[model samples]
Target: MSFTNNIFLLMEKSLKKYGNNVHYSVLKEEVLNWINLKDGGIYIDCTCGPGGHSKYLLSSGKEIFIIGLDKDEKMLEIAKENLKGLKNFKLIKGGFENIKEILEKEKIDKVDGFLFDLGFSTPQIKDGQRGFSFREDGPLDMRYDITSNLTAYHILNKWSRRDLVFIFKNYGEIKNCERIVDKIIERRKKKKFETTEELANFICENFKERKKIHPATRFFLALRIATNDELNCLKKGLENSIPFLKKGGRILVISFNSLEDRIVKNFFRKTECIRILTKKPILPTKEEIEVNPLSRSAKLRVGEKNGK
Candidate 1:
């Protein structure tokens, strides 16, 4: 067998070892259709995750080259192993916000599209060890980039009441957080918050569960966002990619929460160098939500680079 085919066979064998669990790319069809990918076009999967979108993009055309990036090495490993057989793709370990530096290093001047899927992959959330979810008990390390110094444990245990209140209020949008923050501070004084279950239980004890979400949902989300500085990174990522996009090239973002959606909406509105393609954000279909309930809140926004 040829070298490429042998690689493909090896990849298939490795995939069997990882099992069938895979991250499903939200709004896959809509994103592909709107990006308007061309033959031999170059694209960037800013948050490649487990390479769901990147794999599809690669399969779309033989000459469609993809530069897949993710801060999480574990996720990148999955992406790499999944696409090992694929040609015309490069996987990089870095923040999506560093796309300018990445492209510069790669000696590429511009790309046809940039795609950001701002949601946790199935592996990240399901793996209790990584601590992205409250469903399973694990450490409070919520850093997407594990090398980062900050973690959910540090914020909950070491941060002051004032800082705790700030994140709960601002990032989690938890109103009337004085009582919750007070409780957190008091508990941490007795014992350091170390595990996801500990925090989840603490938050649950303080606040009743919301309609469909857990009481700890917003708190965990806030901690993850804070630990990773996700909002800031997202803003920078969008800004950094714009200048590198070919004219008429698109930037697509699939954000899962209101905070991320708001940032994307505002960025698309105020940016002068891009035209908003989706006046209203495209939402997941009822069928998609039924299949993957996690996608219910996904909002996809598109912007095309305009000649200034």
Candidate 2:
């Protein structure tokens, strides 16, 4: 077997022993709801992650054509392994922003179901080395794709106070963006914002409420969203996808924050092509949150394509 296959086998063995403890996967039925769905229909999983939704949908004894989409190559590789030996499932290593183009290329005019579970996975945060979580001290690199040129390393130091303040204020919702920006600018001039620890320390020193969530939390979020163009991507993806969904087809999005949730909310509310199934998002259960603390912020909203 190839190296990718080896990784899959290793993960499978680990999962067999540990269940879903290690990965914290969302599980198939929880998100996809196979019993409520149809078979042999086309479905799209925009975030794809490790293919839990796709695997669940296919395993429900259904003959479905599924596409798993993501921007990160490493994560895509992991999805490939979990979805190995499935001929009906196709994995696309691309951003959800291009979902329309992807479908058009496949010669598919429309699909029955679409899913987008936004943000990073557990393997991404818990690994601590990826630098996505402020709790974990690693390099300041938060780029979703390591192959990408821009990173938190560059943004914290290079961006002007104006840009820094704007992102912190808008994205992080950091009430004290000015203070945070000032600190970042002052510190970076003497040394550099190359590591996560340096940035975290700067925030702690400058902000009074840093202890609540590590002052770097929102700043880092702003940087990550700006670097990846996440909101813009979601907008583009939703714009492109509306036309490609089959009549009565479903669009399910799991957003991690208010910004992303708002995007999905507005798009579904305004668009003629989609009818909102969830006027309000479905949040994770208290039990789920208790079991997996990472699930606290998760919100799920669903939409259905109108007019066949």
Candidate 3:
């Protein structure tokens, strides 16, 4: 086998040995049900993290060709492994914001459906090295594509207090954002923020709160989203995808937080070319949440392209 294939084999082996615990595709039935794919043509998975949704779609025996795109090469490799032996699929290393360019390059005029599952993947959060989670200590790097220059470290240590306050308030939606900014500025002046645990600990120590969730959860989320430029990318991706959808073509978006869901909801509401399919976002079944706790916050919304 080639080196890439060998790597995939090892990843597959590791997943199997560990009982494949890290990944779960949420609201599979709801997504499939909402998207009418009776005569499947071309479907695009915008995020395509580890091929969870794509794998599920392919296994449904639908005669569809899938184009999977992701910014992270590591996730793409894992997706390749997850989708091994699937002939009618192509994987590309790129962000969904460049969907128009990618489709043009591939000579695809339009697509029958699109799937966007927004947020960090399970492996990313669990790995710790990617610095997406506070549960484990790792470098303060939160870029979806590691090749990207900006990192959580830069934001924490180098950004001005004004900029930090903006990020905390707008991105994090923290009520007392200025206080958090003051604390970050104070802490960073003494020593540069280095690791995920260090920053998370600092936030926890400075901002004491009684809540069901961790005090640093929103703070970390804001940093990750800003570091990756995720909101703007989501907006561009949604706008660029509209013109390329075939009449009656479906679009399904699974958002993990209110920020992402609002984007999808507003896009569907304002775009005349598409009609919202679900009146309200669909939530995962209690059973699915029990099996995959990470899926508890997921909300799925769908739309169908207006007929020409």
Candidate 4:
């Protein structure tokens, strides 16, 4: 097996041994009470990361069957293990963008509630080979689905400086995109950047300085987003999912960044079929933040299909 495959194996073994941490889903958001799921109705976990939400409500949702969809098959395999010892649960290796097809395959008419936890699962970030974190020594690849050939490596090495600037400015929210672009191009000309550490070091040494955050944060974010086509995937998923939901079905999404949250909020408000459950997004409390450091950046929003 290749080094990448080895990394995946090590990550799985560690997470399984440690029994991977549990995470909260949108159902726990304070603004979430507005959208209530019926006990006997079906629920969909569109992005079932680590299966914490399902574990919490499984007994309560005993009457409900859950169908979890994800683009990453490795993660889906882990999800199957996490959801083991439970009936009325199914896992599919596919993108949420194919929600209608998944529903069709299940032969289910309409789901009562659909759940989306948009955060990258912890294991993905923790794995050294995935190269999501600056701490890890790994390839620049950041696609959640390794099977999807395109990756951060391709973009950094091949994209025009104009595209780099565009991604940094629009996706990374980083200022001085032009300078960043110039630096990336010049550095790549000397040598093709392959590893996360190599690119991160070049940005640190040659790029403009930032006291608030790492200089490469935005560029990395942009590369990952571009490689995964995340925004479009989310939009497609939502558009396809709502149609398969029962009239009164609910859609709950938890997003980590402003861009993602804004998309979810605006889509819910503008959607004709959805009654916005959270006119404003719900945020984690100070207490919640203290417990889970990642919760600090989280924002939860929900909407219900407008019928009974």
TM-score, one value per model: 0.92, 0.88, 0.92, 0.88
What's the TM for model 4? 0.88
**lDDT per residue as tens, model 2, 31-119:** 66522467778888888777777777777777788888878777778778887877688888888888867888888897888888888
Error of 3 at 164 (Å): 1.0
**Candidate RMSDs in order:** 7.9, 6.7, 6.8, 5.9
lDDT of 4 by residue, 1-308 (tens): 54333444655565566654433343354523534657787888888766766655565534677777777776777777777888888877778888888789879877788888885877677776897766567998998878889889999999898888887787787777787688778878989998988988887787764545666666677888888888888888888888788887888888887778888987887788888877777788876754455566787788888854
Tally clashes: model 4. 0
Please, what are the lDDT tens digits per residue for candidate 3 over residues 190-307?
8999999998888878886444567788889899999999999999999999889999899999999888999999999999988898999999998886565567789999999997
Whole-model Cα lDDT of every candidate shown, in order: 0.86, 0.76, 0.85, 0.75
Order of all candidates by TM-score, from best down to worst?
A: 3, 1, 4, 2
Q: Give every collision pair in model 1.
A: none
Q: Residue 59, candidate 4: how far off, in angstroms?
A: 3.3
State the local distance difference test value for candidate 4: 0.75
Model 4: residues >4 Å from true position, as ranges? 1-35, 209-211
Clash pairs for candidate 2: none
Please give the clash total of every predicted structure, in order: 0, 0, 0, 0
